[model samples]
Target: MGCCVSLFSRKPRLEKDHWQHTQNRRSSSAKGASALSGGGGSSGFTEFTLAELKAATNNFSSDNIVSESGEKAPNVVYEGRLQNRRWIAVKKFTKMAWPDPKQFAEEANEVGKLRHKRLANLIGYCCDGDERLLVAEFMPNETLAKHLFHWENQTPEWAMRLRVAFYIAEALDYCSNEGRPLYHDLNAYRVLFDENGDPRLSCFGLMKNSRDGKSYSTNLAYTPPEYLRNGRVTPESVAFSFGTVLLDLLSGKHIPPSHALDMIRGKNILLLMDSHLEGNFLIEEATVVLGLASQCLQYEPRERPKTKDLVSTLAPLQNKPDVPSHVMLGIPKQEETPPTPQHPLSPMGDACSRMDLTAIHQILVMTHYKDDEGTNELSFQEWTQQMRDMLDARKRGDLAFRDKDFKSAIDCYSQFIDVGTMISPTVHARRSLCYLMCDQPDAALRDAMQAQCVYPDWSTAFYMQAVALAKLDMHKDAADMLNEATVLEEKKQRGGKGP
Candidate 1:
């Protein structure tokens, strides 16, 4: 059975403006636009600015690195929270990987058109100057490699393994039907489990990493024979890679295809099974999967089974449809921790400390820009056309924020900030809360930091930071920030001077 909920249940309906190139850059080709505009509307694609990404990932800090190769990998993957507060996997490619920015954008936009529950969908991309990055939905529950080979608690159950095999087959078949059949480096590492523990095929494999078409990144022994000959990947090459994955699931070890084929021929099926399983798996089912793997491993490309055939063969093997994947995989279901009680304070402080974003929004709307009055003290003579325009943008942002139109508020606030004519801690804090309401804690945190920079002793700035940090799951930091905000508020009430 499929996972309990659709992965796209919260998919963002991004604005058309977000897909446009920045004013400084030349327009992309019509083909790129056409491909991005597919699927009726811009429901699944976004073009992120490099600054937004840097803020999300804390400037690509090594602590956020998630790739198996870590920082040593030419292409590094970092876990980040978008301004919308959505967790994402950002794959930053090497500068030389895609020299032609247009080509990279077009390829990414094409891949972004595809949306499947069994696949970790590509949500956005960045092509700023010489930088190339692809953003995908993050899978919280580790990769198949970790679960299969280096599992800490227990090896994956046979039924779950069968489910993983079937789910990934469906993912590949879906991609094939959608006109994307060539998957690069299809391996256990590319198979990731979502929050529900259901396996998803990584969309990163659909795009060639290098312009030279160097597809496989793993050891040469695991690569398809044809790719060795021509340095190219066809639809059949993907099938060959799938065979290796099946071998991985069956044996729980990275066995060479040639060695696996020899063992199969010798009827050493029992010997090939993962000893960790302790013969718990169904022999009949294992035999059927083994047969399919051998067919996929056939030396001749034409001899390998199609993706559809793999799906059909694995469909009957599913035995546990009612049970959730997490239960079978021994992964704990994600549960929200209860809030810790604290001594009460003023309504705004209490709301901020508790992360009651709606309550905070109400307070912000009521207060309006009154806190900003003294900060932006512009003389009549100094009020230039540019200054008026910037103030007008802030006014527009405030109106939208009051109306609960967060996306419009963000856009207006961004315009106001870009003008750089005046500094308003209130504006930054309000925009920061708007970002929090929109589920983008990272952007909220950055805005909160900007507010702190503008008004170091402001309690609202620290409170907003606390809320953002709490949203990002940094509870310890959030508590510390909240405490600091409380101290700042108490000092302000007592008529104490700024620190």
Candidate 2:
């Protein structure tokens, strides 16, 4: 690990000329990452003058060898330096794509500098010509994916997978729901394991702050259906991915799509278990993981659990040796996840928003005393009426935002934000999400930025900038923004997102 860089404290900002020095970056960052990957060298953020990177990364050698040798290799690639030495694995980008590079860079910048037993640190980078790079401490183990796919060596024990699954979920939940844009990608490939077999998320190229990453490297099979269908990417996707990963851990195989569908139907779900586990795991754990996975994969995005909820669910998985062996072959043979228990919709709340299963569930819960299990429990007519009312609310909010109704949008969200005793970060994120929908980047940027500011050191705000930048076609800027966010976030907590 490395020492922390003081971002909030104040440091000389980089000069523009250094970043714009080259039209070509591959020629510069080829040497530095390895030297920057560990501690006792470049502990904090290391900004390299263009010339330094030119000497280190061999000018961005395509053969730079980002991944390690053998079946277990690292997923991210980078070229940077540490403590004035070269040959580090962390990387800095040239002409970063994120909308708010400062935000991400600020965060990731810190990551390179700190050192801790549980937390990894940032080391160094290449600074030249519209590109900024950071060298972060690298973990030795391969990601959870290696075990999940297990092409050669023995697969990770089922209990270990379950333990990892729970821990990873909690980590991601805290990162996302704690009001930061720090969304974990659940890139099985990025969850590294070492000689000691400890699990860690290799976030050099992940856990980015983005407006939307539904299209990013997520496993399609694990992604929430809403994100897959709509351009809008929400936290529900994160929950969905978490649930899927949990199920996969138990099953000892990627859940097959067909089997998943059966689970939804409430069919023979026990058959979904991984035979390799050979009854080594418990039915209770398998049932719970499966149940949660089904909930997360709800056909409607709204019905899924929030990352925070996943965090609550995950706390129980750690240190459980008897954790079950479940595997995802696909949708379960059972019934699809059931509907959400909605509270009655507030008058000021979104209307069509209620049409989203999640919204509907919220409305039902708010309005009704108990869940109506019978078909006649709540007349189809009454449910339709409630839905219509929510739709109207949604329409009104949309109309206002469309009409430049910032106040109305804010008002609508405010109502939801203050709803009941629990104000989910999703609501806040969604409120800001409105700005993007309304074509107001500055506003959205502010809201997103505020999320970071209020929750300083979280990834969500950084993500807002990343997505805003990406939405504006600033891929390089988006990437850079993610970098800053990670750096800042890394400093506050390792394997944890900021609050």
Candidate 3:
């Protein structure tokens, strides 16, 4: 992000809708704060008071620890209140119980930043310095991993399983290039559910930011071979993890402890899926998902599509009206296919066309999204080649792009076209600020022109243009640019009509 007078980095983040507290929510920890300075969020992080967390988790009692379902490892949870005075569950994190410190922080960061309609919110954090604990908004319901694999005693509608799968994919997209959530750890039991039967991701034990700055993906079972071999996790590796989760989602079963061994033997993938699905969903969609999964789970990370592309592939299903689980599995439904597609995104292969666009767009926004500092995955990648290169570079040095070195800075900005475009708008808009501070209107106006040309649709660009032109004493051009921008916005709102 370039230095701008506005202080707001236009990172295209999902705001108030996701992080803004729903009510006067209060946590045992006072987790929801009105404001905190220098922290990442807009007003900084809102922590759940320990009091609210304890109440939400029933005083963090052992009885709340539900027995682990199926062959999955055990999990314990507690319900508590939040700052809003609402109830939420808190998942306790054991000290270095899973991964490394850096790895652990990355996980929490991803969970902290991930915000989806279907995904839960990360309200606060607790770390005794060395030990870390993660607290989410808490969904009354458990996890899909639980209802499907652990609690076979219960019957999850087949339609619901697919819906769960779809929502999870959206979650992945949110955490992936679309939402640019750096946090995504696909360990077996991380995803949670709410009373509304919606799913939220839990367990940031291994998530990492996808931005070039941090640690990446985890999960040895789902990790791509390319990543593991060379220490690089590509979007392909994530696809592989999605495939592994899909198998569980479809089969409605957990990965039997022994199954990991069987996976090594190449047992039929379908056999691993939750037996509950019983081949009930659309074979075409299933095939695509599974096939994509297979590609993702491939020993090679290059074989899979980025999650953004994958979501585009799955968007079409949103159009299909909700059908009974039986109907989904060819059981029967009065209304199956809707008259038209319900989702606004392209249904079919549109994702492939825009994969790069989505990926870059997502990456750009991540720098500005608010998240917990302890869990910031700004620099964790399992084994991506490029990621490794970046990490190696970081270990070797620090931010050499200081503004003092004008030529070096410009060169640095130029090669990073996408990031440059994003920063240029801010730098350009603050042209006057630059001139006032450094007496460098020449440099300021140059950047302003570039920013305006690069992101013209963005209002900041026009305003910056005004500053630059006015500084150059070309007041007419400056005014004309602002007026032109106004017309563009008005025309856009009126569907291309303006006086």
lDDT (Cα atoms) of all candidates against the true structure: 0.77, 0.47, 0.44
lDDT of 3 by residue, 1-499 (tens): 1122111223331133212221122121122112211111110123434444455556677776643444333234566544333444556654445445445444454455433354565645553444445565555556666666556345565556556667667767756643453334464466666544555565343333322322333345455456557765556655666666766765565453235435535845556555565565665665565555555565555666676776676666554455533333332222222111112322111221222323322322342212111122232333355434533332222132222333443433444323311233433333323342344544555454444333434433444444444454433334433443343344344563211
Instruction: List the candidate 3 regions with Cα displacement exceeding 4 Å.
Output: 1-44, 48-59, 66-77, 83-85, 95-113, 128-131, 152-154, 178-184, 203-234, 255-279, 318-499
lDDT for predicted candidate 1 compared with the true structure: 0.77
Candidate 2 global lDDT: 0.47
Task: Compose the digit string of candidate 2's lDDT tens values, residues 1-499.
Answer: 1111122211111223322221122122212222322222322234555555555557667666455324322133644443333235545442444445454455554343222222233444444445655555454444566566664545566567666766566545434533443344555655654333555555453334332322345445655566567644567766666666666676667775446757646755567777776777777777767777778777776888776676677567555444332222111132122111123322212322222323422332353211111111223443454444443454465455445555686676555333322222333444565666566654555455444433333344555555554555433334444444444334334453222
Best by lDDT: 1
Give the 10-residue window scoring lowest on summed lDDT in candidate 2.
1-10
Report the backbone clash tally of model 2: 133
lDDT string, candidate 1, 1-499, tens digits? 1001111111121123322322112122111222222211112345677876787789999899886623244678889875434577889999869998877887897787675668887867889998999988788998999898888999999999999999999999989997899899999999999877889999999998877757888889999999999999999999999999999999999999999999999999999999999999999999999999999999999999999999999999999999999999999976534223233576777997778999999998887665554444445665678767877888889889999999999999899877665666777898999899889886787788666555556678878987887887555346545655665566567774432
Candidate 3 at 41: error in angstroms? Answer: 15
lDDT (C-alpha) at residue 275 in model 3: 58
- Pitting candidate 1 against candidate 3, the one with the higher TM-score is 1
Give the poorly placed runs of model 2, Cα more than 4 Å off: 1-43, 48-88, 91-126, 132-134, 181-184, 205-215, 218-221, 256-259, 264-266, 319-499
lDDT of 3 at 53: 47
Clash total of candidate 1: 5
Among these predicted structures, which one has the highest TM-score? 1
